[model samples]
Structure formats: C-alpha cells, structure tokens
Target: MKTNFNKEWKKDRIGSAHSGENPMVIAKMRSGFAAIGDTQFLPGYCVLLPSKAFGSLEELDFKQRSEYLLDMSLIGEAILKVCNPRRVNYSIYGNTDAYLHAHVFPRYNWEPEERIPYPVWQYSGEKWRNFEYQYSDKDHGKMKEKLSNKIYELMEKAY
Candidate 1:
C-alpha cells in the first residue's frame, strides 16, 4: 500500500474562491497563513491558511513562523469582532490534509445542539446537511436576497 497518498489540494479546497458555496467568508490571507475550514461553532468558523505551501511551523524559518502567528492573531480578532463569539479556540493539526492552517472558531454562550465538544459536522452527520443538496439559480439568489446589507458592511469593516 502507498503510504504517501498525495491528495489533490485543489479538489477539497474550501475558501470562498474555491468552494463557491459559503457566503460567510470575508477574507483569505496570503499563503503563509491558514486553510479554510468550518470556523467551528460560530457562524463564520474560518481557517487561516499558511502563507507557505507546507504545514510544519517547525520547518519554517523564524520570520515565517512569526508572521504566521501574527496572521493567526489578526484573523482571530477579526472573527471575534465580526461573529462576537463568547470565546475563541485555536487548533492546528494537519494530520488529515497536512496543510499549514489554523482552525479559528468562536464559542458562543448558547449552542443549539446537545452538550458535546464535536463540531456541527459530527452533529449533523454530514457537512451543511441543514440545506438541500442543490438549488435552482432563483433559490440561490433568494438565499442572501433577504439578508440585510449591514452584515456585508460589517465584513468589510472586520476583514
């Protein structure tokens, strides 16, 4: 069996430009930052992708590592200002994708699901299962058609 099964990063990409699904994305940092994942319990659970191509912070130079941490801090602050989560959690484990990224999550005071530490994915049993598989263009436009413009404005301010 092949140990180094090189996964195609492009296939599973999640950022706004890549996925073309999530509307919550406000900004994407340069390569030396983090990846794009479900920012956790918050509405804008985001991933701060590493600016460099690799995932090992230890492998990075002093400058690279410092910048990455700075970027993470900035992203976390932005998320808190935008999402207003009760608390924030940062986790960096590249076991699955082996990409350099930070999991930026906002823990709120009130969560709808049962008392557990699992993500919404584990709760829903699938990704984005609360919505339908696909929708017509009309429904797509209608999806955000009702939302106030203030949210987008806030994103601009936060990002």
Candidate 2:
C-alpha cells in the first residue's frame, strides 16, 4: 500500500489530489479531498483541502460552504472510527497556508492531562519537529490505510 506522499505534495496539494498523486489522501469527497497530515503527532490528524484552492471559506458559495463543512465532519467521523480518540477538534484558519482547508484533530484521553483541555497547539513546538511524530511508512502506513478505508465506507453511507 502507499505510504505518505512525497514532500512535494505540499507544493500543489489540491492539484495533486485531483491528479491522484497525493498518497496522503484518504478519500475525495463532494467538496474536497481529505488527506492525512504531514505529522502524525496526533495519530488521526487529517486535513480537508478544497478541490479548488480558495483563499477563505467566504470565497465559497452557500452550497460549497455546506459541502465543505459536511466533508470535514465526515473526515472526523472516519477518524473517530479508525483512531478511537476521545473527541475530534475541527479548525479552519488559512493564515499560514493561504488557502481554504480544515484541520481535523483527534483528541485522545491519553494526552498529557495539562494539555487535555487546551488546543493541540498548546503542545510544545518540539512536538511538531520531533522525528518520532513524523509520518513514516513503517510507523503510519497501517493507520493511514485504516483511516482511508473507513473514510471510504463512511462516505459511501454519507453520499
């Protein structure tokens, strides 16, 4: 099975998703593509990238907006089934990426107590840079496949 896509996938995420080159992609939904995140600091972390890049959610029409939100939550549901995290947190901020995308983070009970009630960003920067948390074929392939398969199943039920 495919592991994580190459780093170059970031240069054209939406395009890569469309071309079927983004190995990180879990599934393509009505409004966008759901993909595994670069870092697996949170095992089930994923992102929803619109089929076409838009600067913000406001750029999308009402139907597109609703579809995007629905697709994002569908990804969260797949994460819930695959990773079994305590809960999932969804966030949309295009500040860094400069495009419309939603992050789906699965919050786990096993996380440090101090950070449990806080956002995932509360984790030290080291958490983001640490190699152990980085995605690798040996480390994350199985879970990614599980997530992809579950998402396909859920999407089938959803649409």
Lowest-lDDT window of 10 residues in candidate 1? 141-150
Q: Tens digit of lDDT per residue, candidate 1, span 28-52?
A: 4433323333322245455666544
Model 1 TM-score on a 0 to 1 scale: 0.57
Q: Residue-wise lDDT of candidate 2 within 21-94, one digit each (tens)? A: 78778788999899988788899899999989999999999999998998999899989999999999999998
Q: Which stretches of model 2 miss by more than 4 angstroms?
A: 1-6
Q: Which is the leading candidate under lDDT?
A: 2
lDDT of candidate 2 at residue 78, scale 0 to 100? 89
For model 1, state the Cα shift of residue 25 in Å: 6.5
